[model samples]
Target: MSSPRLWLVGCGNMGGAMLRQWVASGVVAPDRIDIVNRGDRDFPGGVRQARDLPDGDLPDMVMLAMKPQQIDDIAARYGERLAGVPVLISILAGVEEAALAKRFRTGAIVRAMPNLPVGIGKGVVGLYSESADAAARDQVAALMTPLGLVEWIDDDALFNVLTAVAGSGPAFLYRFIDALAAAGATLGLPADQAERLAVATVQGSALLAAAADVSPAILADRVASPGGSTREGLNILDREDALKTLLVETIRASVRRNAEMAAAARQSAVGLGRITLFPFVLSLSHRPSSPRTGTRRTALRQAQGERQGGSSSRNRTKRLSWCRNGANSDCLEGAAMVPLYP
Candidate 1:
């Protein structure tokens, strides 16, 4: 099948990388792609580049590869022109599909998180879309196939987690490699030689793990003899699961930052009237009384009083509580008394 006509809004690092791979892999012809950027830059042969979008029929796909903060400016400028575009793919981090849909009218909007390795077609692309139909999804999957490992996220909430892991994982791995080299250098080895050895060791190990049928944990066991130097090193890393804990904390930090960005994007879309609501349900672990009428009566009275007194205003806080059954010990087990919007 012929490749879709693609208009890339930004030809910076990530976008340019994907563009190069698409052209080199024959997934997209240079003539079929157009790139719009603030200034001229190198691109694959036959590809068109311009400071402004060309005047022609809308392309089959419009990719927003610019920074997330530029979403408003870009949408305001091209929203009308790009209305009803078949597929809108955004590589802007932290920008959710809802935010994009609110700004631009499109048949489908896909949020893609691709790392830097996509330049060499060995990256991980995490994609999430709620508006895409089956065909649109297939087109996106096909486009990313040449880039690297493409994963479709079913839950939008987990997109940030994926961004933390696959999208930002390369840099983390690079840091680990650097640390390994530094440790080796500290042990009296030549710094340059240690760096080279560290890089090669990590590369070979990763390749082996990928080709092995067993999990990485099992492969790690195969590398360490029953009572050898490797075992000593492994003990240090595995002590109280130190390495695992450190990684978990690191990824969690990334997840939190991604969530902040997403919130900022949503706030930008909604303007100053945005109010974030966090819903939490408080359930009593133990029964208040002997599951008789005493606990049920008191709980119901308090809930009724709160409901009657509460105001349905954004400024006012609301509370609710209730009993599930009057005769059971778990009567007041679950009582959802969450704050409601005005």
Candidate 2:
């Protein structure tokens, strides 16, 4: 089958990662993809990049990699142009298919949650779709095949749970690696040497676990043999299921936050108007800088103009109030949005 012609909206970290892998794997040709991002980014295969969508027929697929908060704005700007795209895939965490359908007209809407490792083709992509038929699902699966293991989640709630696990799993693993290295250093090993050893140990262990036929629990038992050093350590971690409990709590917290963001994304002007200042803080901190205007202030002003003039005028007063409150220098200088979540 011919490679699907694609349009990628918002080519930031995650989008860039997926694009590189697609070109490398020959799953999608460079010339067949178009990227619309706020600013130019270096990408493999010299794929075309522009601030606006290309003029002509819509591509075979349109992937939304932008912020969840920007959904309404994106729809306002390009919904008409993308009215009949065969598939609309979103990597915006916490945003649902129903939310996408409400804003944009498309043949099918698919939610894809891909992790950072997808850049190296070792990541996990959890997909969930209610409207896509077998043919569309197969097409999406084929496109995502090169990135990593593609899982189709049967339940949307479970898909959110998977997002907490596989989607946000890497950062948690990184924390574990750091803590392991710190523990090693505390035990009198040289800091740098301990870090190197810790990293290598974890890397090798992960590879082994991946190759093993048995479950991780069984593998742990196999490594622990009666009263060895590994067993002593395992005893500490397994005591009252300390490690498992901590991880469960961690994932639960993540799941809760994902739900909050999903709830926020699902809100319309009325719901948005009722939200507290925290959401404004998120918007102010995470809003992208415009290519036309280099500063956040100008970009925000542009957004204010758009929001004031855009379809929903009901929340104009409330939104403007929040915008004014968030215009402080401290908030404007905050870090850019992490592509992983809202």
Candidate No. with top lDDT: 2
Across residues 260-326, which tens digit of lDDT does each residue of candidate 2 receive? 4554455673333223333344554444222232232332343344345444333434444544564
- Deviation of model 1 at 183, angstroms: 0.9
State the lDDT of candidate 1 residue by residue for 10-31, as single tens digits. 8798899999999999999899
Give candidate 2's error at residue 283 in angstroms. Answer: 20
* Candidate with the greatest TM-score versus the true structure: 2
Q: Candidate 1 — which residues are off by over 4 angstroms? A: 269-342
Q: For model 1, where is the 10-residue window of minimal lDDT?
A: 333-342
Clash list (residue pairs), candidate 1? none
RMSD of each: 11.0, 10.1
Q: What TM-scores do the predictions have?
A: 0.79, 0.81
